[model samples]
Target: MIKSMTGYGCGARDNHKVKYTVEIKSLNSKFLELTLRLPKAFSDKELTLRSECTRLIERGKVNITVTVEYVDQTAAAATINTELLKNYFRQLEAVANELGTNRGNLFELALNMPEVISHNEEEADEEEAALLLNAFQEAVAQLNEFRKDEGVVLKQDLSTRTQDILRLLTEVEAVETDRIPLIRDRISQYMDETVGKENVDMNRFEQELIFYIDKLDITEEKVRLRSHCNYFLQALDAADANGKKLGFISQEMGREINTLGSKANHAGIQQIVIRMKEELEKIKEQLLNVL
Candidate 1:
């Protein structure tokens, strides 16, 4: 049950005190990269929110935006001490310049400083915070559902491409059965033309022929390729597609297929190997979106 790394979800909750809206969007990425933007009032809970997002999303480039609409605009207006903020910013900028640290986030840093935002000496509104948390949870749940749906589509595409490669593998096997005989006959005919057939030692010729044919043999490659494909298909059906695991399996498949191609003296088998490689490339592309 793999999930896709791409999705969008939004959740909203409103009450007499305030309203909260949370929107989350995710895209494919090799690791978890989260960018969260919320009102400064919830700064204390930022770490908790981030931890929860990481737990749920697992991995992706995720962007979360939270919007808060208070019923009392006048009350919200008086929340920030502007003069204090300006003073804090000036000091922070001077300190940053003196320390040779970054000054890009001076305003944001000053805004989050203690006493910069005051609610008339009262504690934070627990009820409003709970509402926002609930909205965020809803958004994450919706996002998970979206990912699951997309995962189904990815799963189907991967399965089809893998089966196509397996089918092409069988085609390679069919052509491979005639390879040894063809190589033996071609070499014998060449010897007959270059040196009279009577001059060739039949026993030594047979021994050398066996050794040459053994070098071109693709039996082990075919077996390993088939095994890798079967393992890939099995992994696809697991609880999580585990992209890294599938990627490793695909790499193994590629090694075997490449060996098959290099050793394949027959043009028909080579063409089939080309098809398998194409199918495998498609599989790898789809795996990029898998979770």
Candidate 2:
């Protein structure tokens, strides 16, 4: 069955020292477009993680995000500069005194200044890196399962619509049977009005009418359209992803339906052709999301 490109999955794992959470999201696209968001500490493992993700997912616009939290806040907290804090306080205190404002709470203001706080971003050690990769692989597996479930629903919808077009083809054949006599009678009447009925040769008129009707025959179009519809259904049963293959088959189906419509001069057959086109348009729209 075909899998859908739209899905989401999440996974988390925690060591005694830190907790790691991984999330995966995807949407439909013609090619793979991947983006990763990670904490500064784990920047070195980005390329390895990216390669793994590419091997797992073949298509879609994908995003992977990782978050981490230390078990002990005091061990991983930001460091403050005492001298920068003191310098900021002195300048701010002088300005406040000149304005005659209250001098209290100056220390609170200085603590929040830009240069007063700084934290060194560290590199991910071997243990932490392994934990994150394990969590990420679990997330990718869950996302693939989500896609398989959605694929079953898509297969059902597409099969139903293709059957509908087949039913409509039967209707076109029924309406076509009664059309030739009407065309022949209209042409005979026109000849009577212009050249007089007694002056016309019946044998020659019948021969020309047969040749003209042959040009309007749609037998070949109907045969080709039915074949294309069957091929579309077969592609859905394949184990591998066949989204691009299905798209090409549908284009061929459209060409046959259009030919049918052009050869059908009767109003009833033309209307049936329009309905078939409607079903085909819907199939194309749904194929955009298939994987």
Candidate 3:
């Protein structure tokens, strides 16, 4: 089945100490391009996260944002250096005495001094990392589901367009019979005008006309175009990533359509070819987002 390259998903997990939230967004791209936004403590695991994303997402421009919010009061509590605070207060009091000023708000001044309150940098914890990984997996699952849903709609649109092209091809076939006779009549008229009808060698002219009409025959193009369209539908039903393969098939189909257009000497057949080309272009545009 086909899958689209654009989607969005979010997953969150909360524990006693921390809450982990993971959000991922994807857009169509020819290759896998990933951007990560995570806490400094988890910076070392960026490569692992990228590898996981690559394994899950075949091709797209992906962005991941991880948020770690501390829920426990103790997790973010700052430690006070009581001895340093006491020393600063004593010094400030002495200074105040020398200046003959009251030591108002001395404790507050001491508490604001450098080194009095400090927060220890948090380290990477294996258990917390595991929790984050779980959230990431959930987010990926949601994204895949989103892609699948979009793929269903895309599949329907593509199928309809392909069938439309096939219908137009049939119309081309309906008017094909007139082309040969028209060409022969035009050639005969030209010969009669250039050289008198009596001087024209009828047998040789007939043989040459047969050869010329054969050259302009679009029999092979119509057959190959039908085959290409069938192959495109088959690829859509396959259970693998066939975006590139579908693109190649569309190119082949375009070739046949172009050849048919060029060889179609009748105005009606040319109009049908134009419609087929329009439908084929729509298919190509949609294929860019398929995987």
Candidate 4:
């Protein structure tokens, strides 16, 4: 089944005093690219979170944002580092004495220095973190489900486009068969007119006609294009991410279609080639969103 690379999923859960919300957005890409925005407290889980997303999403350019709202007011308290402050105070007192200045408010000055007032946050509880992980998993699962549903729609649209191309191919093939004999007869008449009727060698003319017809023949191109169309359908049916593979196949199909256009010299065949190109272009545009 095919899945689109574009989708959105959001989830939220509250545990004790912390409320967590996870939002994920994905877009088409040649490789798996991930960008994450998370709270500073959860920075330790960055690698693990990215790994989990990689394992679950498979492929795409995915952006994940995690928002944490702490509901509790009792955050860690800030306190002066008494020992460090004392050391600073002692050094300052020595310098002040040499300079003949009073050591007034020296402790207060030392306390104002950075890292002096440490919050000494409590160690994060592993269980609470586990809850967060579980919530994240649920959110990812919901995201994948949304993508799957979107994929069903994409699959139907792409299949219809493929059928359109096949129909055009059939039309072109029919026109080529009818055009070949007429082209050969016209060539023969032109040759007979240029040379005297009796001087025109019928056997040699027939040989040249065969060679000319063969050069303009698109039978091989039609066959290869049809085969490519069939393979595209097969790839779409497989239960894997086949966006890149589908893109490659479409390129090959385009190659055959272009070759057919170049070889088709008949007005009818050229008209059909134009229609075939239109259909193929539509298919290629749609394939960009598939995975």
TM-scores for candidates 1 onward, in order? 0.83, 0.83, 0.86, 0.83
**lDDT against true structure, model 3:** 0.89
Candidate 3: count the clashes.
Answer: 0
Give a tens-digit lDDT track for model 3, residues 32-98. 9898998777888889998898899878999999987888867867799999999999999999999
Tens digit of per-residue lDDT, candidate 1, span 85-171? 999999999999899998889999999998898763143478878988999999999999999999889988988998898889888
TM-score rank, highest first? 3, 1, 4, 2
* Clash statistics: count for each candidate: 0, 0, 0, 0
TM-score result, candidate 1: 0.83
Reference-based lDDT, each prediction:
0.89, 0.88, 0.89, 0.81
Worst 10 residues of 2 by lDDT: 118-127
Better of 1 and 2 by TM-score: 1
Cα deviation at 169, candidate 4, in Å, is: 1.6
Clashing pairs in 3: none
What tens digits encode model 2's per-residue C-alpha lDDT throughout 1-291?
799998888888877878789999999999889999998888888898888877887888999999887875664778899999999999999999999998898889999988798764355677888889899988998899998898899889988999999999989888888888888988999999999899899899889889989998899999999999998988888776467888999999999999999988888999999999999999999999898
Q: After superposition on all CA atoms, how large is the RMSD of candidate 4? A: 3.6
Go through the candidates in order and give the C-alpha RMSD of each one to the true structure. 7.4, 3.2, 4.6, 3.6
* Candidate 1 root-mean-square deviation in Å: 7.4
Kindly provide the TM-score of model 3 when superposed on the true structure, using C-alpha atoms: 0.86
Q: Which digits, one per residue and each the tens of the lDDT, describe model 4 over residues 1-291?
A: 888878888877766766678888998876789999876667898899988887888788999988766667455446777888888889888999999987887878888877778752333567657766777887887888888898888888878878888998888867666778788778878877888669988889889889998898888998999999899988888887477898898899999989988888878777877888888788878777776
